[model samples]
Target: MTTTVTTRTVRYPADGLTMVGHLALPAGTGRRPAVLIGPEGPGLSDAVRERADALAELGYVALAFDINGGRWIADPQEMLARALPLLDDPERMRAIGHAALDVLLAEPRTDPDRIAAVGYGTGGAIGLELGREGYPLRAIGTVNGLVTGRPGEAANIACPVWAGVGSEDPIMPAERRDAFAAEMQAAGVDWRLTVYGGAQHAFHHPTADHEVLPGVAHHPRQAARAWQDVLALLAECLPLGEQAGRAS
Candidate 1:
């Protein structure tokens, strides 16, 4: 049977910033597995909101959190101006992610112990930072955000990580991807990286209202393939009938 999915806006405070997030809840009683979504550098977009709703329809309480204090940026330069500094500051990323996690857990329908995080671009970096900060996540999925963490910090990641990126993405090039893989390997974490052939940066993002920058176009075929990979990761790691443990 198909269950109803409900969505709402949630306002919260994080690191002196008033964050606004989209919360999606599945129609059911008691606790259910939850997902935390991090939007790209452009902040929370309609596509990200829709992803949350889709997760809810699949019986996962979902929250697509804000970055940039609720501003959805369209200018590429403006987005880089806001995102570059935050990417360098892992603590700030963790602050925003944890704040969103708190709101997700506050929902009576959410199963606090069973949660995963999926993010894109700048948001994907935040999700990885949360994993590095020792958050108890069953799985971490990222697209175009294969950012390597601080030296030795990835040891804190307690769950498998699945990352996807466009093979032609200039932002996360071959050197950067190799570095990320090295980090994960050294930390003994189970991680996988999928490179979508001939795609550009942010290929998974749906077409936006404004024009995208060079090397940042959407690839529909690869986007669909990436989503399926994420769903597979979630199913394997956060199965509805089982509870996973936190990092030690």
Candidate 2:
């Protein structure tokens, strides 16, 4: 059976500012599992929206959320100015996440309890914060976003986490990776990490349209493989079929 996915723009308030997000719904009727997606520091773009569309095609309600009032940051410095601080404050990130999540949960097509969260770059850290704040997510996936958080908090995360990063990523080097692993291990959460060799930060992105920086480029092969890893994680933790019922 072929299904047609639908896409719509959603606007909601977060941190006293309006956030614009994209929601994608699968064809046919029942309630479906959802994935709350966050984009990199440069803000939401077609890349993340396409991810939502892809998930919807796979029968999952997906939302590609924004952090900067529906705007995409075209400058690296500006993005860093806004994102770097939020990364340090888990509470603020959770607030932004909660608002985006509310948009996803409000949709009649979504199964509120069967949702997962995934983020790329700074967005990835925000999704992890949602899990850390006990959002009841079924799974969490991060690509180049394994940034650490306040200590003793990974224990709050209840679902499995999957993180993928470039082995050559200076932003997230060996020491940081080791620390993240230690944190997850101490919290006893089911976690996994895959470091793609010869790739740099944000390697999943196909181009440098929004911002350009050294050590930040795309790797076609690694990007494709990382996407496959994401799919596998979602499949194992938030499987589709049988549970696809219309929202009540």
Candidate 3:
């Protein structure tokens, strides 16, 4: 693993809009495992970019892809106004994820076959959509992403899926969490779900610069734990220097 990491801004077209993404690369030889990062409802922010860089430091090429084109809306209501419809449409989310995947794969440093998707909030839903669309991901990890996929479509998920959410998150209440777990279970997918006690929605984004809505607050401790869980998943499913077999 390389300690030095490099990052860059990439622009690509998706869903009739020009999306901007942050790509992070680790310093070393050969192609390396890659991760696609999806930002929360506020769109791509510095927090997401830093995560990509952190992944790069761990020797994985990471791309923090943008939503809402290149804009970042800090107003909670406005953000929801823009994100709600898109969240309801799984195909659109899948298209966005695929576009970002294309960008990640085009990079010379990325190992196309050893790839994973991790997302937060709306971005997490996008990652799940990618899994449901049969993207051959090594694993899928979501934080506070309570959205569920089409009925029976989870059967296409070829990789292990992991999710983290706050126990008190009203947006991702017990009912929704149960439904998501049921979907994965009924599809016979390898999956796990962790509920962070005493935390609220979006607990993983303490670095967010916006005024979050009610029921959404950052819990630094749980956020760190969730991140460690994500790292553990990658280590298990997409370990570096090993050409681990994955669904083709």
Candidate 4:
């Protein structure tokens, strides 16, 4: 099937700053299920746009969000400097993400009831925050995302969660992963954690540099698997169609 994908630059407020987002919409006649794609560190990149394209090809409207106020940081220290504060400010991140959600839901061709979110790196953290705040998403997926923030954050998530990580990731260790899994279980959330063998942080990035982030490498096989898993989760949890009682 042929699909059309369009990109638009939109702005939202986050932590008192204006954040820009690149939204990708699937072209068709009726409303389509939507997904919020959170950005990886270094803000919006070509890799993110490709991901948006991939999602749109799968028949979902995806918005690749801009964090860090649309600024790019080439140095690892600079990136960390900007990311650290946002990671600690979960509430603010949630507000920003929710604002983006509002934009997506307001789209004329988007199905608000069947919304979901997927994030990478800091973006994943934002997705987790949104899930914890009880957003009405059918599912949430975090790819190699950090597991810091708060312990009570996962308790309020009402939908299914899929968390993918690298087995050799030092940033998010095995203990932390176990703790996160335990918290999700205690919160009664349907959750799955997949650790890809020999994969490290940011394994999905096609342009990832192992020198910048040691032990963090990208594997095409793992990335493809993760993408397929996300698609399956979305299909199972957020199918596109009208309900019997809904007015047409």
| Top lDDT hit | 3
Across residues 32-148, which tens digit of lDDT does each residue of candidate 3 receive? 899999999989988889999999998889999999899998888899998999999998999999999999999988888889999999999999999999989999999988788
Winning model by TM-score: 2
Candidates ranked, most accurate by lDDT first: 3, 2, 1, 4
Off by over 4 Å in 3: 208-211, 243-248
- lDDT preference between candidates 3 and 4, better one: 3
C-alpha RMSD in Å of predicted model 1 compared with the true structure? 3.5
| Candidate 4 lDDT, 100-206, residue by residue in tens | 88878877767778888888888888888988888878899898785654767677888999999988888888998998888888888899999988788888888
TM-score of 1: 0.95
Off-target runs (Cα >4 Å) in candidate 4 are 146-149, 241-248
Q: Native-vs-model 1 lDDT?
A: 0.89
Where is the poorest 10-residue window by lDDT in model 1?
239-248
lDDT of 3 at 204: 87
The list of candidate 2 runs beyond 4 A from truth reads 209-211, 242-248
- Between candidates 1 and 4, the TM-score winner: 1
List clash counts for every candidate, in order: 0, 4, 0, 0
lDDT of 2 by residue, 1-248 (tens): 54698899999999778898999999877789999989998899998999899999889999999999989887878988998988888899999998888898889888888999999988899999988888899999999899887888899999999999999888888898999999999999999999999888889988752248777888889999999999999999998955845442
Each model's lDDT comes to 0.89, 0.89, 0.90, 0.80
Residue range 22-136, candidate 1, lDDT tens digits: 9998876767889999999988989999999988888788999999778888888998988999899999899989999889889988888889999999888999999999999
